[model samples]
Target chain A: MKKIKQIFYLGIKGSNSFLAASLSAGNKVKLSGLASFEEIFRSVEKESSAAGILPLENSLSGSIYEIYDLLTDSKTFITAETEVRINHALMQKERTGLQKIRYCLSHPEVFRQCRRFFSDNPSIETVPVADTASAAKMLKELGPDTACVANPAAAAVNNLRIKKEHLEDNRNNYSRFITVGRKLKQHGNKISLMFNLKHVPGSLYKALSPYARLGLNLTKIESRPIPGRLWEYLFYVDFELNNGKHGFDEIITAMKMLTKNLKVLGRYDKYDKIKNS
Target chain B: MKKIKQIFYLGIKGSNSFLAASLSAGNKVKLSGLASFEEIFRSVEKESSAAGILPLENSLSGSIYEIYDLLTDSKTFITAETEVRINHALMQKERTGLQKIRYCLSHPEVFRQCRRFFSDNPSIETVPVADTASAAKMLKELGPDTACVANPAAAAVNNLRIKKEHLEDNRNNYSRFITVGRKLKQHGNKISLMFNLKHVPGSLYKALSPYARLGLNLTKIESRPIPGRLWEYLFYVDFELNNGKHGFDEIITAMKMLTKNLKVLGRYDKYDKIKNS
Candidate 1:
């Protein structure tokens, strides 16, 4: 039994709600703290943790690049992954009815996440809060006249009543969360690397050329702005290969000679579809 | 004289801080209402606006694509342009010393605007408020312990005192604000367009090849996800050319069949720098 005492998360209010449910579902990992990106990184650096969960990307808003940067910056190896289906529950204090709810409090992302819901209900004012959790906290503190569209967890934590559930217009809405810890765990079938190729034209194509020849399917290729480099970028990629294989070695060798700052984060299993019993 | 009574803005908090200063520079144009991107568009659709100011792009944070979409979605035309040399002032209630400040409030954009500032002062927690003006509003409501990095106007509006001025890490920080109204004011000489090319290999290059050949310098190119079209994008571009014998007609001709849905919002001159004098 892994006595997972502390799990640090940098996420929205609903993230905490979902996390609480997840933690309870698993080995009862104790909720130690909730911090923003910077704070969370600082804490992880100082202490050991069972897992640190952070949002990597959203379906609608594209990627949350900052979180990705932090993951690389801290050198914390991604240990596991989780996917929480986002159901942005529109809620207020139990006392406040739908008519009395004047303002909708949410993080800008949450407001965006629930764009269709707001478009359908254009009469109510939607105010961007700092985070979904903070909005939930504020609603609890400010009371019923103000409703919030956030995660079920946020409503649970903040003690607000959900007036409406699954308010996110898209039923397939989901955010991918990555769990990182000190030790690298090999799932034995994936390679994730971040690198910057020389910025000449076709450099991206050139870097991927070797992989293409080997028939290695590139699962993900994301470009993030390299600090201090104008228009140049560092690409984080997840390719379907392991460190031990001969083909993987050839590709890695070619990539190293062909790019700048080639870093191998780890080899992990590709997250296939979630299974249900 | 035009009695421009209302100003509608599609921005997060702190976004209008610089503009707030400009608006406070006179008493004529009052901020009638504040709303998100969707609300602002709906309001403008129902009636004409005095001036609608929206942050078009940031040097560091790329472009605000939603605003561009709003511009395209409506018949409102770009009338004037302005640039605010951003100075993120850290403010708290008058008497609160810097050491006493625990939580920092600002828009997420402003938080990114002043990332280094917060990093250097690690003890202070950052709370992303919705609007720069609202950050000030929150600072005033929360009082001394909370400081915010916002525009001087926000400080003035909320009656908060500037604990420290020019707190943004980047000295060259500026945000371009576009003033949209019903008709082209014949002031701005630069034209902005939104269009999309076929999503084929070298398609982007082919689209821009004409601009490079014609000696037309592109001021900006930003990609916005085409709604419901996975991975497809609409490119928002600003091309600089005087409407003269050098007829933009050539470039228009080049783009005639090359791109899809090419709509010229309006042509206007780059703004004269706003003066405190």
Candidate 2:
């Protein structure tokens, strides 16, 4: 068996460090430093790392555009995928009560999840940190008076006491992460493409007509702003098509006539939740 | 004219508050407490407020969904509108040095705008507060050691010093605010509506077909997730059909058959820099 190379994880704060540690499991895949999308991309481009994991979307906050834009702009291809179920907890140092937490540190999303907790305690000021793991790090450094709202893994990793567990508003809160590398290898059975339609009425409907006519089932479609254009949008679409040669060619031909700018990001199987499931 | 009552302003942390204050002009309308969509909705519904001014969209951040959702859900009517050129600034107390500042507080959107500024100073943490005005309030309470990144009005309102200004990633920053009340007495030329088409192909095409047929030009269309539903969306549309009587019923009838759900929020004349254009 070929040896697995070093993997670097790039994400926008939160519990990415904990997730990376879990993904590594008992393997010898040494986890590199946790960095931002721009930093990780630079590292990958300069051959400083072999593979990197990035958060594609969150259940509550929707898409992380920075990573998406970086993914599209880079020559990397998604190699593997995983979903991390986030169980948010309010953590502080040992022997501290909830009322003693004068300052709360967390990401915007975590702050949003525990809105009720914060609302009930209006006197406690909430501070927005860049990442959940970093919040834990800071909480450990700041000691008992400062509590951090982060995942249990974050609390455990930083040796902080979990004051309150399962603080997320929704029970099934999850974030999907994708591994991107310099090579192209399809493991899953799905094709993802992104495109932009003209800023006119029925433009999106017209663009998707051929697919609907051919009985192609679209799995997901998300629209994000096209920078520089005040209100224009670009749609990212994922769909399931046959993996064989004939079925693939026909879809490409249909896509060609649908929009002016078409980018076939990759074709891979749906990233299933096998490990945690 | 009748004595104007209190005006409820839905301040967007920084720029919108200044624009709203300026638009109130010499009228008897006094700026009530600055509030967000939820706060404004609850305030106006219970109080005797005359008008509510809230932001609809910004050039960089797209639409403020909390305001839009409030507009659609509440009993507010469109009365007037205004626009403001946004200029974000990094602010602190007069004598505080940039290096001395340990924490920076602002709205999440403003924090995003000045991400580059924070990138340069990795040691200083960026914190997201309720709004720009609130951030300024915290800065005043926390003293000079904690700086705030906000608008000039926010700085003046909270008595904070502007350490640095115009800290946006993009130069052409602008935000549009709308005035809504329970009465349609004030005139406007634009109509805004929201609806949902069946998830099939060409549904949106057929739904928008009548607007083109009636020669009524459509201005804007935006989509937001239908709360508590997966794989479904409701689209918000702004259009030009100010005639009030002609072709309104027919256009709505055509759209009903082509869509699963349709809701007309309100209608008004084109936003005149001050009143209806």
Candidate 3:
């Protein structure tokens, strides 16, 4: 039998990261929790875990910006990708009625998703906690008058009752997670890379023209500022190639000559299904 | 005598928006406070105020995403722009020492800017409040063991003693603010616009080539997702035009033909100096 792989993610049980790590490829996967994204990357660097899972972007919120910055600065590469549908639940202790709840606690991002819910219940005060699962844990300790907005999995793990399900205003909420490892894995059609261009007119256009010339489909383009350099940006681009890696080397060579500090972050297959089991 | 213009901003006295509103070009600027960004925009639309002041982006924390989304969705136009240097200070009740500060309250973004301070003092718990000024107001009511991270103006307004000045990790921290009004102001060197482009290989490059071809200097480019569209993005671009609206009409006409849903958000002069008074 193959040995189980150790995977580390941010937050405790019933968190979105936990769910994402569980879905990552491995016959027998052992998931561990870390306090911050920095610690997760450090653990991967230390070789304590085979891989680390992190949320890259959300369909509702534009991007998990801190993760983008970390990916740009770190040495790790994405090995795989997965998507999970976010379904937030309003949970509390048993026998707590809707009118009895006065405060709602959860992650700040979670609160943003449930804006309409809070607007409907104007009396309930929003309290920002560490994460969704920890908020559920804290809600269990608090009085019956308090509730938490988290996933149903978190409510079950913390022994709380779900008063309202699918509290997010948008029903099509989804988040994309990436598995990070030490070495680059090359079994995918999609490639993600980051590069810096000079602050000049049409510099980005010239840098991105290679994709169009080569008939590759560009999926996403995001720009983040370089630390200490005001107005200078590091552009992250994701593209899909249907053909084999025939002209990939030449394209990358030409791209490097056109742009500065070009780094290929990952080449991974895009996974969109939610594997709850 | 010229009539005073009523300008609304976010937060109470001594907030960054308050300072930005004061800098608006009016004979006598009558500044008012609003609880949220939506309220400020609504007040501007209702004609209760001549304009609204809002922070567009920060050098450290990137863009104020909500404002970006609001600008894309609303019909309001930018009248002026200003830059404010962020100098966060740690403050508490009279004579409270650093050791006595068991908890520090401020906006989540402010906490991010002061990461080094919190890492050095790990024992101090960070409490997320509404905003920096409100945190100072809350700290005044809380016990003496609590402190808040805000600007010196907030500390002075709330009667709190500044224990440590310049708490932000980066000394060059600055935020750009824009004044929003019903009509577009003409006296400006910069023009900001937003448009949507298809997810094609050279879609963005083609949309931006007009600027380069017309000898216009592009200042900034940011992309935000369209609400229901999964992969499509609305690109926000800022460019400087040296010639006085000479070829601007032709450029806009060509840009509209190349891009989808092109909208000119504003035209305003860029302000970079610190004008606290």
Candidate 4:
């Protein structure tokens, strides 16, 4: 019998990261949990896990910047990518009237997504916890007067009763997750890279022009402050090209010449959007 | 006697926004407090306040993206700008040893800046509140066992003892603020604008080229999702040119042709960085 690879994620059972990890690895892998993104990265680096899964960005709230900062300094490569449609559910230990619930607990990011719900229930005191699943667990321990906003899967895992479904203000909210490991998977058409360009007029335009000239599709571009350097930015870009293209090497060579520092993070398949069954 | 203009900001008496508002409006203006950015905008729109002050970006943590999104949707023009040096301090009601402090209260953004302090005292429980000044007020009510991370000015306002000064990991942290009002302030050299380009391979590069061609210094660029449009972005840009220069009208006309939707948010003077008085 073959040993199953252990996959690590940030949060307890049934959190979004856990669901993303399961989707990325399938049934052959065993899922484990860690307390923080730092811990998950350390576990993967130490060979205790096959890959670490993390949410990279959310459609409504924007990018998970800490993960972006971590990617800049870490040697890990993105192995896979997936998207999870976020469906926040309000859960409690027992069935109680909405007016009776006095406290709400969840991760701060989840709170931002449920602004409408919070505004409607202004009397409910909100408390931030480490993660959504942990909030569900805490709600279970706190009993009837307390509730939490998390996923339905988390409510099921914690044996809590769902009081409200689709609690997010925007039903279109989706989180994009990426799996990181020691080696590149190298099978996908989409490529992600980070680079620092000289601060000058048209420097970014020059650095990005080669892709445009090559007729490549630029999907996303983001800039973060280079650490210890005020006002200087490191740009992260995602672009797509056919893997069998002939001039890919020449393009890479040209990009290197245009940038002061550049690193190819990974090439990975774009996850197909999973529609509701 | 000249009627005093009212300025609104987020948080209580001694928050960073309060200080920024004071610095931007000068002594002749009366300062008012609001609970959130939405309220500030509403007050400005309703003509209850002469202007609204908001933090646009931080050097260490990147953009205050919510403000960026608000600016994109708002008709209010940026009339003035200033930079405030951030100096976070840990405060308590009494002189208590660091080992005795059990709870830490602060705004979530402040917590991110004080990661080193949190890691050093891992046992301290962190609680998120609406603003740093409110956190200081809460800490005072909670007595000596609790400490809050806020500016030294907040500590002075709330009558809390500063247990530790300069708690932020990076001393270079500074927040740039912009004042929004009904009319543009035309005395300054810097101009801010927001626009949307048709999404394509080189759309952003094309949109940004005019500034480079005219030798205008591009100071900042950010993108936020156009409301109700998935994956489409509205770009915010800041550029500087000599206020007395010729061809300004021609540059504006050319830029208008390049973008689908364009609006000049404001033109404002660059704030001189005050280095510890």
Q: lDDT tens string, model 4, A1-277?
A: 1232988987689788876776677677889998677787777777834778998876555666677667766767887788777888888899799999999988776777677889988988888775678788877668578999888778888899889988776676677888888775546778888888656667877787787677676677766655456556777787777455734466678889998778888778877674220
- Give lDDT tens digits, candidate 1, residues B116-168: 77878888998876667777777767856778887776676667788788776
Q: Kindly list the per-residue Cα lDDT of model 3 for residues A219-275, writing each as its tens digit.
A: 777666554575567787887875774456767897998899999888888665555
**lDDT rank, highest first?**
3, 4, 2, 1
Question: Which regions in candidate 4 have their CA more than 4 angstroms from the true location?
Answer: A1-4, A14-16, A107-113, A127-131, A170-172, A225-232, A274-277, B1-4, B59-61, B107-115, B127-131, B169-174, B223-232, B242-248, B274-277
Give per-residue CA lDDT, model 1, range A1-277, as digits (tens). Answer: 2344566765544554345335433565655555466666666567664566666654444445566666677867765555566777888887565667778988766676577778777778988766677778777667556788777777677777778887765564555566666666644576778887544444555566566556565545555434446446677776666345546668789889878888776665665543110
Give candidate 1's whole-model lDDT.
0.64
lDDT of 2 by residue, A187-265 (tens): 4567777787666655666677666666565655656546456346677777666445337667768887878678777
Could you list the iRMS of every candidate? 6.8, 4.8, 3.4, 3.6
Per-residue lDDT of model 4, residues B104-203, tens digit only: 8887767766878898999898887756777887776786788998887778778889888888876767777888886666567788887886656678
Best by DockQ: 3
Tell me how each candidate scores on DockQ against the true complex.
0.13, 0.23, 0.39, 0.37
Stretches off by above 4 angstroms in model 3 are: A1-4, A23-27, A59-61, A107-113, A169-174, A224-232, A273-277, B1-4, B14-27, B59-61, B108-115, B168-174, B225-231, B243-246, B273-277
Please report the candidate that would top lDDT against the real structure.
3
Worst 10 residues of 3 chain B by lDDT: B268-277
1 against 3, candidate with superior lDDT: 3
